[model samples]
Target chain A: MNFDNMRFSKEHEWVEFEKSSEVVTIGITDFAAGELGDIVFVELPEVGREVKNKEPVGAIEAVKTVADLFAPLSGVVKEVNTQLEDNPGLVNQSPYKEGWFLRLQMTDRSELDELMSHDDYSRITGTE
Target chain B: MSEPKKTPLYDVHQSLGGKMVEFAGFLMPVAYGSIIDEHNAVRERVGVFDVSHMGQFVVTGTDAREFVNRMITNDCSKLLPGNLQYTVMCREDGTVVDDLLVYVISEDRIILVVNAANIEKDYEHLTSRKRKNVEVSDVSEEYALVAVQGPRTREVIAACPFFGQVADRLQKLPYYNGITFYHRGAEVLVSRTGYTGELGFEVFVPAELAVALWDQIVVAGEDCGLAVIGLGARDTLRFEAAYCLYGHELDDHTSPLEAGLSWVVKLKKPSFCGAEALRKEKAKGSKRVLIGLAVSGRNIARQGYTVLRDGREVGRVTSGAFAPTLHKSLCMALVDRACSAGDGQFAVWVRDKEVPAKPTSLPFYKSRAK
Candidate 1:
């Protein structure tokens, strides 16, 4: 829940880097989940698929609408949350923890600098 | 084009954290929290929906019944007072104008409940087709409507203190029937009908008393698991029941017979608005038929998605959703009659990808109301 270490995207995604590794975990923010209503299914990208920053690599299917999951940073998909295959509600229930979408090996760590902090994201979404 | 109108329950929805959206010229709630939760609550227990945005019109005069019978596709002559009929009004060419519920009150009075988006158009259609001895009045602003649905719907209503003696009679009120009583000197009508495939009631109360009525129902259903639903859940519930949404399934270009609403289109009726055109179409046979499609993919086959038979496009999806109750991706589409005959290899174009689909029978979910 600490925003000090998290980087948020204008598209409502959040990214957290590992302590010393180039790998960064990605997921949509709670505000995004709330906006999408009840998530029923999620389409995950295959591991090792190279993704570009701001490019859609996967999709999240809610009860009424579908949203593209955009990559917050350029990287190769290293791991995906397989648990979301059967229980997509986790994205709404725990947007920052277990609902994490995928971990990517960062191609450009500097991309995180361009992302917004929790404060900036809160302001953009008017969640504060 | 102008500022969206707000219903009497607008403030109540805001306080409940409802996600408001502009729909049919009114600012209404799309969901309070989760649509699936609201949908399940209606299927398993009870749920309430604020549908005040829907339009209501009253027809009165000596020739009201006869005028109504000539306007709608259904035989209103068979309906007794206090009966309700799901019917459609069409143009002279057999194209749909709007599908509405006809509330037959008496030989000289009737009520027409129409969809919100089509209020102005329906009013114009009715007035243009108006006959002698009949008068049409738009009373939409005078009433606020709420739908309470589920297996436990009756229990929730019976517990409401304001209902008084009417509660006892409502229990015996058969399906498609309604009862009217005076509440605070204002006429209130409660009908045993709903869009969801469950035992439900649609209450038309005075606009001024709408907030109080909604509050009372919420309090009464506190112990029995009642969720305050919004438009999101309302669509899914009705889609599960295969109810034809006005814009989705029924439109100005589609005939009632092709929409699989032949049962309600009484061609035997001597003369109605579209009776002649419908009779001819029925004899010639409809070229298109509405069919259900079960998508075998994670992605939803959304509206306007192309339906494919082999490699050729056959039809377009009308309405689709990940059915919360069924837990499957399903959609309803109007396809060529040849493609509707038997279950065959079908697919839906979800963007550029072709997802496998199967031609299934209409109504992916069965009705539990009866």
Candidate 2:
């Protein structure tokens, strides 16, 4: 996937911002998806819930283990991908796009500036 | 602790994109691809598991049959030659040492397949309790075990060219039975036994030819949708079948009676290790019992999760998972017998929240193994 427009978090989440808007889309990166393995269920934060930066907002249930889904940015959970409720496999199949976890209305846009660029993210993931 | 051991197929697994993890003092594959995919492959078509990490022992002597019959909880006399029986060895106090498969080769010879983690413990236990006429030898490193399991296991086994004429014998082999076949001038034992609740077969081949046999089976089962399974799926499959894993359900502190393995405890046998304790427990009834839980939702009630009744801690989850075949979250818990009374509703502490759960029948997914 072309991740040029996305900002990556150290926690392996990706955030895409809407041009000139405070709204941003967040999802786990491909590396995280591969590590999670066969996601059976996704517990997304409820809409309108306040989320803190780097705090666990929900959980991702895999076949053998469970992983916490951390909030990449501080915001109100504007929307959650309801599609994940019934089909969590999408997170593994399309980690970057359709697998997006939540739409956040950012309370602090400065958090996005602290996120890593595509190159930095790749370096951390050792994909570079 | 000593460094973990590696199996003959370690390199092959790495080449196949397997995710390796340390399990029971061995570097084993946890998943080749997706664990769910591997799990479904076994339930629907066929799947192969490298169970080489499991420990194997050979017992032979004039009194081997009599000796073994007195060691385990199952009535080994009922197991005819070429048959296998699932049983547990316990301490004199009735606490489990390990759960194993006893393969009856003959009246005076037997093969004991034990858990990988309990190799040394089981070996020592058997030898310490041995009689002068019986001999016990650990042959764990001599064989590579592969389990081909699922509804399509028969077709896949028949397609393997390496089996040659033995494939025909394996095809007709009844469940819980094994056959000794000659391959490359060595004795190869194929048994119709598996932990998965499915029609399956476990083949024990010489260690040196493990990779070759694995390759042949892969090629042979290419069109049958056979995937290379790993320990992750193996545990899930066994959990769905309600099979007791050594450290999970059956442990050093757990009794077979409390583990819901009373069927294997042949108290009728005059004397055996743990016979007295088991008989006493059977008479007084067990303090706690293993029960299946139909967890309400996605949040898995993992091992160590507290099972509560009316906000009181009753027991803990032994094993839990999202069963692929049943498409629901299920768990096996050892709860106080009082929890079974009145309404079936209970709660499982999944982290901070108490997820609603209720007692359910075991073998969560009815096994098709028979």
Candidate 3:
């Protein structure tokens, strides 16, 4: 996955869109993963479930604390990452690739413009 | 509104990039890097912890022993010099005041180490009960404690220049015993006791010399893979070992019997604070008891979460975490005595769902001799 092409949410989630499909992949940013420490469990929204932007869809449990995983954009859940059931540490190891949370069938593709670009996200995370 | 207090090793923790957090009104390191790495380091090798945030009090006088015996639940009359005993202080109603370690320096002198958050309250309690011939003083500010624990602890201590001569003594020091030795014209008290279920030692030194002592031990244990641990791993380690933390497993409203600390309470003692209440509770049996719960899933159960049996709330989790050593999600909870009986199953409310769980024994982990 090209993180450069990803759009970011203020809640630290990122969405990547395909050129020929309305389906987009979502995951937490590397900075968010690092801050949360070791990831032990990831609760993903079920496929076919519709979610609204900024809504609480699932949860992530770390060794220290638990946090809510928010929906980055309104859409229908296409596919949930079943691999995370046995290997939640994948989020810590590869947040953008194998650790991608779920695929969403976009309701409105124009919402991508409201999300921050990679550079803007980096600036907000103080990584730039 | 006031700045949090700092330990003597504050600068050292910052230099090592420790993640600092406020605990018990003191700024302490939660972890230097990965808490799991630090936890594993202690299980496999040796690790040092700067636990200077814990409080200490010195009791000395002709009536020291007699006075102390009246304040705690443990039978300290059998405690000889150069020995340590784990005990709990209680209020008149038999609820816990604080759990502490009593180091018998001599017949007339003893040192009590208590939780940092309970320092002032414990001091006040001790002073208020002062008798004609006894003197109780809060010496917490004058001391710093460092714990070196794991299988390789003895080798690491022997490798140090200051402790080499006493290596054999340290190796021979039985568990729950201590000795005083001179280090650079200062008296350092070393004890064979630790919270982790490992062969370990705790050293008490003058606060001013804490930095030097920490640095030397770090260098000596470098070859043994001794990592500096923090409070994050400390809680996990102790929880796995089934050690009761003051605020979590114990509180003013919790009794020692309910906390599974009956071994430390002595009913045969002639007279002690809360003796009558504890005796009555012992005869009547406690209404609630502490029990271990092992969750069946990866979702961890945290403190304050409710435990249920047949869809009814039975208890609340006091301490819970993913056990790094056991590779299981476990917790200690205080529940209705009836729910903890027989072969009943439990479920812990994690987030919006109730995850299945079952009662288990205390101490999810134990160290195997090498």
Candidate 4:
């Protein structure tokens, strides 16, 4: 998937915005998935719940450790990927596409400015 | 902080892409590539582990057998020359000091393999009780331990020419037995015992020759799909077999009987350290007992999680994980004996919520080997 327009948080979450609908799709970055190893379970946020920027929305558990998933921006959770309930390995197999965690209706459009761009994210993650 | 110690196989682990972590005051590999994959490799094929961080003590002298027998819970008098016995040493209060393996090399000479974290403490405990004509020496720094485990373990070792004449003896070695052989003019002890619940072998080699032996075994077993496993998979493998880890299952405060290791405790032995207390506890019964739990969800119930019965905290989890081979989240907890006697219904607090769990039999997974 092209990460050209997607913005990334330092915690390794990516937010792809749809300007026409004021909605954004969020998921963990490839680097995050690689470091996490095999994902056995993912606890996603409930749809329609309010979320604030940088707040923990859910958790992702691997065989060895557990890591929290943080919201990239302030919004109302519009949808959660229910497929993860039975198949959490999707997060490790395809973190950018099929493994997208949730969709949020953006409450503050300016929050995207605070996130890093594709080039910046890649540089920070040392994935370039 | 001072730098952690490194094993002789440290360079080999790094070159194999093992992710190193600090454990028991040593820089050790937690995983090579993926823990699940490494776990499967051991179950289906064969795998090698660098467990050199474990401590070894050599006890010898005229009174060695009698002295050693009195120190542990198991009957050392029953062990033959090549026999290896799993036993626990306890405080006078019946609580465990550490669980260790005793290799009965001879009537006068014995080797005790102990946990890395408890080396100094265990050595001190052994030396504190002065015995007539007994000599105890800590030989941990002089040796390295490599565990080659799985159904295909014998084939892998036999293929390696570096093992020399001992490679042939590996085929005839029975479980819980060992033999000392010469490797590079140094004495190496090969034992048919493992923690992974598989037909396996643990080789004790001189620290200087450890790297060479590891490389040759890896090369010999390459075609048979032997991967270099780390401590992460090692823990899961042992947990599936319901093996007790030192700090988690058995501790300085927890009795071995409560840890479901009563079979190792011998009450008829005239007298031993903690025997009187253990006998009393046996007669009165224990208040808390270790039981296995199967959580209803994928979220793991980690160590220190509170176990609840009827909305009240009854116990705490000691070790828990998502068992990769079993395809379920399993945990071992020390709960109130009364709570464990019910219809197997209980709950474990994960994060903030109480996840529904049920008591299951110990050893969530059993190996196919005889």
The prediction achieving the highest DockQ against the true structure is 2
DockQ of each: 0.82, 0.85, 0.74, 0.85
Listed per prediction, chain B TM-scores read 0.98, 0.98, 0.98, 0.98
Please provide, for model 1 over B128-228, each residue's C-alpha lDDT reduced to its tens digit, 9 standing for 90 to 100.
99988999999999999999999988889989986877989998899999999999899899999999988999999999999999999999998889999
Q: Which residue ranges in model 3 land beyond 4 Å of their true spot?
A: A1-3
Q: What TM-score does each of the candidates earn?
A: 0.98, 0.97, 0.96, 0.96
lDDT of 4 by residue, B1-370 (tens): 4788999999999999989999988899999988988999999999999999999999999999899999999999989988999999998899999999999998899999999989999999999984779999999989999999998998898899977687777788988999988876899899999899888999999999999989998999988999999999999999999999998988899999999999999989988999999999999998899989999889999888999987888899989989989999999999888766756459999997999998889999888871
- Candidate 4 lDDT over A1-128, as tens digits, reads 67776999999999998667789999998899888888889999999999999999899998878899899999999999999998898988889889999999999999999999989998998888
lDDT over C-alpha atoms for residue B299 of model 2: 83
Tens digits of per-residue lDDT, candidate 3, B142-233, equal 99999999899988999887676687898789999999988888889999998988889999999988999899999999999999999988
| TM-score, model 3 to reference | 0.96
Model 2 per-residue lDDT tens digits across residues A31-113: 99998899999998889999999999989988878988899999999999999999999999999888989999999999999
lDDT of 2 by residue, B1-370 (tens): 7999998898999999899999999999999888888898988899999999999999999999889989999999877889999999999999999999999998889999999999999999999999898999999999999989999988888889888878778878998999997888888899999998889989898899899999999998998988999999998999998999987898999999999999999999978999999999999989889999999998888999999987889999999999887899999999888666677568999987999997889878876454
Poorest stretch of ten by lDDT in candidate 2 chain B: B337-346
Candidate 1: lDDT over CA atoms? Answer: 0.91
Give Cα distance to truth, residue B303, candidate 3, Å.
0.6
How accurate locally is residue A97 in candidate 2, as Cα lDDT from 0 to 100?
Answer: 85
Query: Worst 10-residue stretch by lDDT in candidate 3 chain B?
Result: B361-370
Which residue runs of candidate 4 sit more than 4 Å off their true CA positions?
A: A19-21, A118-128
